[model samples]
Target chain A: AQTIHQWPVAEIKAVGSPLSLGCTIKGKSSPNLYWYWQATGGTLQQLFYSITVGQVESVVQLNLSASRPKDDQFILSTEKLLLSHSGFYLCAWSLDRNYAEQFFGPGTRLTVL
Target chain B: SQWGEENLQALSIQEGEDVTMNCSYKTYTTVVHWYRQDSGRGPALIILIRSNEREKRSGRLRATLDTSSQSSSLSITAAQCEDTAVYFCATGYGNEKITFGAGTKLTIKP
Candidate 1:
């Protein structure tokens, strides 16, 4: 069994402030990691994906960047936050990329004022 | 429909009734995944149907995929109050990125 953990269950920050969120997966090695953002009642938008350590790919330009510092860890950060950045951030892991089903973490709730 | 340039939809039904959610995509896809999200939680994979499979069933949930029509549908039987959540259909066009639908909010009244 694999478990995914996300830090800072919730955060309230001012616009233009710096922000960082972290996720760690246990019991799975070389898993594909992904970051997603969703508005309160809107669709989920993929932000970034990581296939290996030290390598990350951006799916959309939401002014956000992601880094895979370790095989089991992924970080999502931005230099300056925007009001539109307020939403629920989710971390997901999968065994494969193309057709694998992803397991998501508890998620982090961000409020940019 | 919940996918391709459409807004989110809401459906309310009484408990023990059956409900179906639909999604239509514009691009070509090899797989269609169905997910459900509770309030303030991440989406969980409920069912997945491949182009070759056409249709798949698990317990009380049934998923159908029509590659020719570029659409998919998920049906739940004997809906319970705990089934209230948002359902989304996602497609993978044989790529790393998976496109998700706008989602449908289902409310099961007990």
Candidate 2:
């Protein structure tokens, strides 16, 4: 069975601080990875997606960037965190992008102080 | 822009009652996915209905997709307290990306 793991289960950061979140997938090869952000009671927003290593596409611009450095690793980073950046960050993977069901990780809860 | 938006913002029902949540999309899509998100957790896929299929059932949950109307609906029969959560409808336009709805908060009273 495939499993997805996200690092730093929760984080509390101040505005203007650097932030980095990581996600790793096991038991699956060459899967599509996606980054999603959701506010406390808002809709889920797609931030970035990567089809292969070193190639990431931006779905929404929120001053965040993602990189798939390895086949099973994806990282989301920002130099300066903003108050609006606080939310739940989710990592998902799918076998294919076309109508395929995505599996989500446990996710990371971020709070900007 | 948000692709899929649920008609009802929230719902409250008693246990064993049947509830239905509706979603309407703006663009054409080949598939519609239903997901349930518990508090402080990631959303999980509960059902997926394709354009060619009108209705699909999984245990006590039923999902219906109407291509002509550009809408979808998820129905839960004999709801339980555990069914209390936020339900979202997601639509995929080809291979571009899957967009999610705002979700409907369902509270089941025991």
Q: What is the alpha-carbon lDDT for the whole of candidate 2?
A: 0.92
- Model 2 spans > 4 angstroms off: B2-8
Compute the lDDT of residue B109 as modeled in candidate 2: 100
Superposed by TM-score, candidate 2 places the C-alpha of residue B104 at a distance from the truth, in angstroms, of: 0.7
- Count of backbone collisions within predicted model 1: 0
Task: Give the per-residue lDDT digits (tens) of candidate 1, residues B1-110.
Answer: 22578878999999999999999998888889999999988999999999898889999999999889999999999999999999999876545687789999999999
Cα RMSD to native, each candidate? Answer: 1.5, 1.4
Q: What is the alpha-carbon lDDT for the whole of candidate 1? A: 0.92
Clashing pairs in 2: none
Write down the C-alpha DockQ for each prediction.
0.78, 0.69
Worst 10 residues of 1 chain B by lDDT: B91-100
